[model samples]
Target: MVFELRPASSADLCFARELTRETMLRYYIQHDLRWQDEAFDVAWAGRENWLICQGDSVLGFLSLSRDAKALYIRELHVIKTDRCKGAGSWAIEQVFSMAREERRSSLRLTVFKNNPAQVLYQRMGLSVVGEEDCFLRMERMCSAAP
Candidate 1:
């Protein structure tokens, strides 16, 4: 399916919050992790937040930030119904392109160790760079643009 990333606005805050809460709750529950509602926030106004869209429908959203060293993926969430339909992969590819355009040497993210998405990251050529009690830090070296 065709998907695009659009900058998320204040108008999209509620949808982003609800989508994140729901998806994260399921993820936490399945992994036997604690869910703290107080700690949950979509940060919709963040400059790097983007809504994953197909036409008028908002399928999911991702939040990314960059420094001179690397592009970091702060969050990536696709509604449960939309998972496995290619939206997540599409979004990551867009981020990869963005990192290359910015001349970032690498893309980095932390994924819950038990989250199945870690497998997807591996498939995308990211390697484990470090690990925390609950998360695995992964990085992919971005090739220079041709």
Candidate 2:
């Protein structure tokens, strides 16, 4: 299937918001309700965001931020229909490429302990650098040239 990757815009705010909500519901523990518009505003207000689309349908989204040494994957989600089909991997590779292009030393992401994506991260060479109660912090680093 053909895929399109594009930078997110204000016009996409609504879709992004719904995507986030659906993702949370599917993959996360149920929690109390909150104001969605406000939450979406806070999240999409800054940082770099991208949408993974196929034809007219949005398949997933990802966001990133960079510090001096590492690029952080702030968010990534693939719809249930598209999971395990390489969309998430392609999105992650894009982040890693951006990190390499910027001369950053590493790419990092946090995955919940129960998430199957942990295996994917390991396959991509991201080592578990640390862990919290229910989360794994992973990193992949490229050695700097002399």
Candidate 3:
């Protein structure tokens, strides 16, 4: 489907937060972790937020940041109705492009253990590199674009 990644604005904050929280709440519960709206807001304010939209309809959102070692995907959540419709994969491809443009050697993200998104990350070429109490850190190396 045709979609665009628009830079998320303050107006889109509620949508992003709702979508992410809905998507993550179950995982948080399963992992016995807390879901704090304040923490999410703080993170949203700190990261680069992008809305994945097909025309005027928002299908998902992506929150990204970069460290010295990698382009980190802090959050990626597709709307429930849009799941499995290629939006997630497309968003990931865009992140890969961004990582290359930024000269990062790798793409990195943390997923709650047993979250189904782990399958997609693996399919997109990321490998689990580390594990924490409740998360699996995944990474995929890439050469920067010329």
Error of 1 at 99 (Å): 0.4
Residues 53-141 of candidate 2: C-alpha lDDT, one tens digit per residue: 78888898887877889999887888888888888888887788888888889999988777778899998889999998767999999
Q: Check candidate 3 and list the clashing pairs.
A: none
- Model 3 TM-score is 0.97
Show the lowest summed lDDT stretch of 10 residues, model 1: 38-47
**C-alpha lDDT (0 to 100) for residue 62 of candidate 1:** 91
Q: Write the per-residue lDDT of candidate 1 for residues 46-76, one digit (tens) a residue.
A: 4478999999988998988888879998889
lDDT for every model? 0.83, 0.81, 0.92
- Model 3: worst 10 consecutive residues (lDDT sum): 26-35
> Highest lDDT, which number?
3
For every candidate, C-alpha RMSD to the true structure in Å:
2.1, 2.8, 0.8
Task: Score candidate 1 by lDDT.
Answer: 0.83
